[model samples]
Target chain A: MRTEKIETDVLIIGGGTAGCYAALTLASEAGGKRILIAEKANIRRSGCLAAGVNALNAYIIKGRTPQDYVEYAKKDAENIVREDLLLTMSEGLNRVTARLEELGLVILKNENGEYAARGNRNIKINGENIKPLLADAVRKCDNVQILNHVNMTDLLLADGRVCGAVGFHVDDSTVYEIHAGAVLCATGGAAGLYRPNNPGFSRHKMWYPPFNTGAGYAMGIQAGAEMTTFEMRFIALRCKDTIAPTGTIAQGVGAKQVNVFGQNYEKNYGITTSQRVYGTVEENRAGRGPCYLHTEGITGEQDKELLKAYLNMAPSQTLKWIEEEKNPSQKDVEIEGTEPYIVGGHTASGYWIDRERRTTLPGLYAAGDVAGGCPQKYVTGALVEGELAAKAIQKDLKESGADQGRYFAGQTAGNQAAAAIRGIYSHHLKKEPGPYSIDQVEEAMQKVMDQYAGGIGSGYRYNEKQLDLADEKITLLQKLAMDLKAEDMDDLLHIYEIKERLIVCRSLIAHLKARKETRWHSFGEHSDYPGKNKKYEKFVNSVLKDGRIQIIYRTLQKGDIEI
Target chain B: MSIRINKEKCVACGKCREVCPGNLIKIGVDKKAQIRHPKECWGCTSCVKECSVNAIEFFLGADIGGAGSWMLTKEEGDIRHWIIHKSDGSVKTIQINKKNSNQY
Candidate 1:
């Protein structure tokens, strides 16, 4: 089809929480400059917050300072979090959330007329339209152009610097070649790498956004950017049947997790939010589970607020509760351990970033779930990083001497780039049919991951033998990716999605194999190495070097650890 | 669990299809929301929320809900009431607020 070329000063991929906020920052700071956001879905309803969220998980309230917040996150991640990034993000968390409120988000208030505290650092908010709110705020900016329903396939590079990115529209199938002075990868995090809890007829049902298939991580890997913490995946303990956020019962109504014997089990493990999932899984393994979030003691007002929290995010949970004729306030709500997912939002699995949110690649930056090292970022921290990245981009533009926005003179550069990208994707248009369809390949990859790479089937437990099998199967899947064929653009999108996932999968396996210790606990349990090892506390960084995956170990610097 | 849409109550507004992130919901020839690929559905329940006529519901599946369970949403101005029918013949109701509706 049609070929369209777009030129901008900044290109933001994936208009989710980070991208939208980045667009807002760029528009407000660098007025009259062209900013483009290329999103696979409609920006107003995309990414993890598409259905909205219940609370600002990273907000620093009055009693807590930024350093205190960072310390809490560092402790939760078992001292593996990037203190520098967390400190910077925490410093801006409250301001960003307040700005969101000023931009129309309704933050719940206490009787004292202050932001109400839900837990230690989180604040309650009626964020039912958080995405739409951010979308509207970005829409008010004149220079920002949002290209909805465009799937970005690859990043464009020249002279060891990122120049732009290329993609195709989901509905129109028009090839889009975008050239930008600076590119921000905010494509959220990965899902579907492992078999979901509800497989078949509901495969897309998972904790994270299903459409966020690790495109950012994959593109970064392909571009030879250093990525970290692929081994420390994010596993959530959610509502059993609906896979809803347990925060509604836990923090919203202050419900504690209880086993089938009606014993409060989380306290036994000295659990943090991330460790709670592990605790729940271990309880189930000990035959104490079929665990439930105990909410029988909450008052009626708290129950109402708890329902409000669910309405903001995962309203289906409330719907399920209503359908099941079970009031959480009247009875304990069942909770289940979701399958492990590759996410930077909860865990620290994404691109390694500097203090300015700049990736290793020149002219490219990353934030939010795509930027690694910062865990428990949630929505507010992502917004803070987005603002940080945007501010950095604006400052860099002013100090640079190179001609900016002039390279996109006409369609030639973009067309040439588009043609080259199309060449890579041309295998999908090949006449020779491959042996496997997209679904078959996906299923095979999932099965391999589930059985070997610490998926739900393995109770998220992996050993050297399983990792070896995962390695072998993933290698075959990568080979199969090259011979894939598609009948149309939709199929082509799936092909690329699988290809990207395969790239991430290989990286995941490599990282999983490198880390011997079971550091991630329930998220990634290695049977061969059953306990946490201080030696492996450093980050497991991986990069695609000369078309091969290479692993590196980076010890956290003194400053990174101590802030 | 997959989303269930009541064809009899549907008015073919297409809001559910529009908000469905996976694009799994389609308007059949009968002008009602139909799931094209039930297996691929993300189960985000965006369709259920966007369906103002209460024509949509979410089934938690036999594995999770253990059969005989149902979920529905009732909107009252700035509040949403969720009513659940549990497998054990119990009922629960929860209310949530919807503030500043016109902002988005």
Candidate 2:
């Protein structure tokens, strides 16, 4: 195995939405500088949009301003969200979305030739090829380089600043040491952390990409960056069995949630989305039985279009409908709550970044699902964050004369870090097979999180005792993770992913324990302190120091943007 | 839902394993399509659309899907045709137009 040493101006981990857009932005503006994207999978069909998306969930359409979008986001997050990040994302949403449209994306239009609006801030689109299109656009840039199948294991930090990253090629098992002037981490969010609804072989049946095991969050935590809002995990209410997003039915086709009694129970309770999920759990716990997403009043055309939307995001739901001999035009589809996920795209949980998407750690910028403080940012907002991060990196480079030589600060420190990381991987290969397999360690972590943390087993609920157990068990699991051994390259990738997940798990437990009040309801339930307290209406930020996580609170201030 | 590969029909091209979003499939040592982890399957059917030999089959389990129902996928250029066979012997075909591959 040969080790490849590459030098570039900017290094991006994860060639998903944010990394691709960042590469595109820097290539166009950075004066012929090299931009490299290290991805775990092929960029043309990777990340959450690998199958494509049906609607632009964060578009600021006609009659709806960016301020309205920000206000709605604040409401969605229970009145405690980063107003600055939301305002910044909201202001650039339409511009970035329109740019995508010009780049060969087909935004659906109504008979009047206007953009088809789903809700107040969403527009319909035929985005089945969004990822491929973005990948193609990024490839067209001469300065951008994408290295697929390289799994980023850790950030290369020297003197508290990220100078590069270390990863290994999955196919050839060769180490890659990439040194850059700046590094952007946009590796999406953690999935498969809590026990998924369909465990075992069906574990990939999840709302988020199962492969994104919190690499971005873990790397940031290990680098001692401040992370916020891990307590406000995202628990999506999806279609039963398939775990498909219910937005296609609820918002796409104007369907409503009905009970097993064939009545509009959610409407009867006057509930919102989170309340609806809680109501369903309560109904089932009270022996009312299954709930359904009733599409009885939707027209045939609407139902057909709804299925098309499902085809874009999660086609399995449409196939399951056909296999079950059920059609939305006739009968309703069952709806259920999925396992909780720690994500920043839907919830406000990730690296604590300021206005420029810059983390507390110098030379390290966060974007996409890894950048905290904004919620409901979906695809377009990630693109905006990527663009902002790129501009900030470029401005910093220009100010420093572009050739100030960042990696020269600490050659000894860099070599020590690189050697330590290489030794960790080499030890796994040289040792006799360890007692615990990677899967067993992953299973132990997930079981502890699901049973004690705010997973579905406790009806998305948690008590103080359960949280304490989660903290203790997660710590033990973190120790156990070191003993995980691998026999092949694929196993090595899993070992790295599982290790990152445990690092993220520790932060999640610390934040959950710190937040005494139940703020986000089903998303972050605290049964011991069930009521929402105004005093606890702040962000829970944590930073690891001296082998212990120091948790703190940050006040959510109103931004000058008025959004 | 789970995907089943026709071992006899499979040419071991590994296109199905390459296109699967969940990374659930792999080529066995015997050079045949193997569903390594059936439970982790996200049922995207990218494998179904990419397999030129049309050797892959998908069906939902009895717990959710009834008996005698099946699904087959075929691609003609940019258009994918989903042939769904219902439990009642009736079949429905859905044509999904994909973005042109030549564009990129």
Candidate 3:
């Protein structure tokens, strides 16, 4: 009965690091035009920064080149990463890192005037928060209009390329096309695909923010963009279930991998080595195992020892600060539960783009954690990709003699992205009766994730049969996620978003299924085929095509770029 | 304009109404705090933080949030998010409780 259409020159899907940087990059150049940022939550409350991490890991300094960053990442990834994307990220890290203070963020400095960094990757600030700071900068910008709690339902395509996206306002329930000539998906990774140790908060321990859900890649796949390396998921291993690095006391803290004797057994099995991502996977493969999804080594006494250290060590930095803030304290922290699937970088589905963060479809871009490829899955990498994508777009538009400002949120005529959203929201799910509920559907999906998808003692231990079972359960969950009810427009969008995650999950499972010779060794954690092989599957990318996903192998020529 | 109360969120145990040093609120039968007319009501948000029901909302916009917060920028409020306590429930701040120097 009513028609609504609007357009923009560029559309960025996620409001995380990449999308925010892109918006900031555009801020100085473009004014008085249209730029619409549709975020699931407020932009400051985005992926990576949502839980307040203090640093960026992908920074490259004056002495360092992109080549060094690339080599470090490749070494960290055990030599299974794309050279071009990693190099591009590291080379551009300084641009993102240096601009934070310029944007009015008050970060702490040392006597040397350098920002505090840990693990030689992250930056530390005086304030114990990240999202609030990022949010403060974003709210001040004039060119951007943020629609928080808005979920992207579909993509608008013109002649088989991405033109824009269609999303629903979850808070009040209205739909907007959010059109732009070029689109970027910075939606971040999927931590919900597997069950994480942090249960009450949802399964997003260290992998990523919970709601990221691979929607960017879903947009890419739906728009028919080429995606790469979806299967190379990162699984962070920790001794305590604290997701460590968060600077908090665990329910218990001890070196992980205790033997049946209940002793510090990881060293005896020889797994405490550095730069070794897959040592544990190899151990489990040989059946010398901590072989548990939820096996943590910290006893109750150990938990008390670690928490007491935090409570008494540094009042400002310790549990006392949390206590003053009325946050949850270690009232006997849940040691690692019986299951352990800390799967990261696994939301393999996303807008397939180049090292420049340009999608295969020109004018459509992707960035942040949502942007596909590179040894991605960190804030710095996302920031680098975000900055690179913005530069590329800014350069392209400037060179083309095109006024990109005139094109913000433009018209879509049968623009398939809008039409798809129209069909899902206005047609398919809208016609259903009052009080349609997707809560039960989401709850059930979580239950399935906890039970079937290598979680809560449910994930297949890399066997053909278990993997096949995981596949069936995933398919069933996808159908349920789609057919589920929606009381409001946001629920439908969330349902649609769930459909995207299921796709990513299947792709992750497919890649996990395909890598017969486990190259990632310990961290990928699929121990059934756990022997490291350099010669067999050098570098593989999972590309979803024509209703089926295929893992094609391609190798870099020897002596291409020395580490 | 100042000290907005969500009646639905409030579970009137009179916690806020009781702790108000400024005597801004009084408990009503509806199980919510009734705000009396505010002329000299020095916008102390002590009652706001005291309410455990999460019924009270604070404002940063001075009139909306009130003048009470900026006025007391110097002193600690009557209520805090989490008051520190040694084994006994004595009111304490972040610094080691000098009163409870005997206790660990």
Candidate 4:
């Protein structure tokens, strides 16, 4: 059979924030050299920052010193953050921003025209358009070529190390292989493992890009890369079953969190509102559920008031409130308290790497939201990590004599990865009538996540029973994934991505199970945790081996780390 | 005055909440519109007519966008539309209501 094969110096997957940044940075380093980006979608629309991101988690803009910011983060995650990681992050912020600025991307600037502060210490970012613009930069570079509308099915392993990937073109089911010196997996995060549509179904159900099914994460795990922080999902307390930020109202309005008892919840919990991270989580655990941040308690009111600076800025929460309180669904769901808006913190999952973006696996590197650093899930963090990984690759390439690595094969891969994808493409193309189509499997997955498994209303209370149910449904999805057929190009991408979601979902379940005490989120209600675990102040990270999950906690022997 | 929503057409994009004169309007489980801060809502159809899903029902009186977010004295029929002012100078907000209820 006629097959397609391509080769490059660097092969990056997923066209979202990390992939785009990796492409751009690689181009800068390998000027006139070749690079390929295998994006399931075109350059302008990547999964990472598709709907815009929440904020720049790592950009310490004006007032906050990297050292001070690091100290604050350490205390917030209950003093479990790795000190070295925090320092690397703090130090790397400016150079990353300057790189973007040099790329024609404009970050909000200060009065002196330097990169402006989103918070006192962080840069105010425009999440909505940053990914596309980054894609544009990648496109403009002559050194990089984006193989769009292609779904990556497997990694090309040279002696158990990632050398490249074999993917199929979504349009006509054409198979292609890319052999590279280094393969950077930036396939964004896995979403679409489940969807939430309680009684008041979403007026819009497409909360996430349908394609971010965690292809990269699956590839890494399958490749034997160690995954971390899989359980500490970047969960959001979604409002009215829809994905909206209560943080917008809480952190924005400085609304004091009063429990149903109307007591001073924050004070009752011994929390000082100045600490933004833990304070909210603790309040929720104390039955403060959904509450307005009181101006008297915290300066969070600035978040709301500051939004007025935007053009015609209106609060997104009001509509969410109307639906939750007024919708006609039989199941009465209120998102005020323990509900979380769970989105994959892609970069949040990888092994604890240094500023150089090195994964524990030599020659394996991670960037974007898929790479882990405490606050590494934002657009800026992903951007910075991507550049750093590329620079590391540059150094490695210079030191090594591995010219045997990275080749462009005009013929597509003929192995398991390529064959696994070919079956799906043919199934969809042939329009096979089966037990489930790709969409059906996806819908099934979403229902399971939203209804039972600590989705919204999960005051950290995912009973072992419900977790089993989620697990059963997850197995069904995996079963369906194997037999499922596709209907179109999008369906083909969706099906394969669903497999990726299963990996993320399985990891998250294990993570949830491992954490005996709910730190940020309460157990079931997601609204309440009785008391602090005082569990050793340590980091909770996860890794996969031989298809099994492992959990680790890193804390100072004292349960709090020494600065 | 309360602006009720036509639940059938609403898509729960939450665009109304972003523009609500009052800090009201939220997305419920079904992804439909919900009233959050009823006291906060100005009873302005900014949400009612502003709703692209057409989920919002206009109340008797709410300063439709462009009418009073700024001192806008346009044609009553033109008032059906929303206009936003940009100080650094840009035109934002699209007035969806082409027919003027004020004239009627």
- For TM-score, the strongest prediction is 2
Instruction: Give interface RMSD for all predictions.
Output: 4.8, 5.5, 17.1, 15.7
How well does candidate 3 score on lDDT at residue A10? 62
For all candidates, state DockQ relative to the true structure. 0.32, 0.32, 0.04, 0.04
Q: For every model shown, what is its TM-score relative to the native structure? A: 0.92, 0.94, 0.72, 0.70
**How well is each residue in A347-389 modelled by candidate 4, as lDDT tens digits?**
2345556557666555567776566544533556566667777
Docking quality level of the chain pair in candidate 3: incorrect
Better candidate number, 3 or 4, judged by TM-score: 3
Better of 2 and 4 by DockQ: 2
Q: Across residues A330-358, which tens digit of lDDT does each residue of candidate 3 receive?
A: 22221222232222232223444566777
The C-alpha RMSD in Å for every predicted model, in order, reads 3.5, 3.1, 10.3, 10.6
By TM-score, is 2 or 3 better?
A: 2
Top candidate when judged by lDDT against the true structure: 2
- Report the C-alpha lDDT of model 2 over B1-104, residue by residue, as the tens digit: 67788898999998777656555677788999898767556666667767888888777654444365777777688786778777788988887776521110
Worst 10 residues of 1 chain A by lDDT: A402-411
Model 2 chain B: weakest 10-residue lDDT segment is B95-104
| Pairwise lDDT winner, candidates 1 and 4 | 1
lDDT of each: 0.81, 0.81, 0.52, 0.54
By TM-score, the candidates rank as 2, 1, 3, 4
Q: Write model 2 residue lDDT over A1-563, tens digit each, in one string.
A: 56888888889999999889998889988887889999887787778887677778898888888999999999888876888899999999998888898888888777798878877777877777788789899989998888988888888877777888888876567988888888999999999889887775456767888888899999889889999999888888888877888876888667778788887778554355577787787778877769888887667777676666676667777877666555787888788888888888888899998888989888889999998889989999999999999988998877877545655455567667877888888877666777888878988998998899978887888888988899899889877777777676667788888889989988998998899998776888888899899988888899999999999887878863221
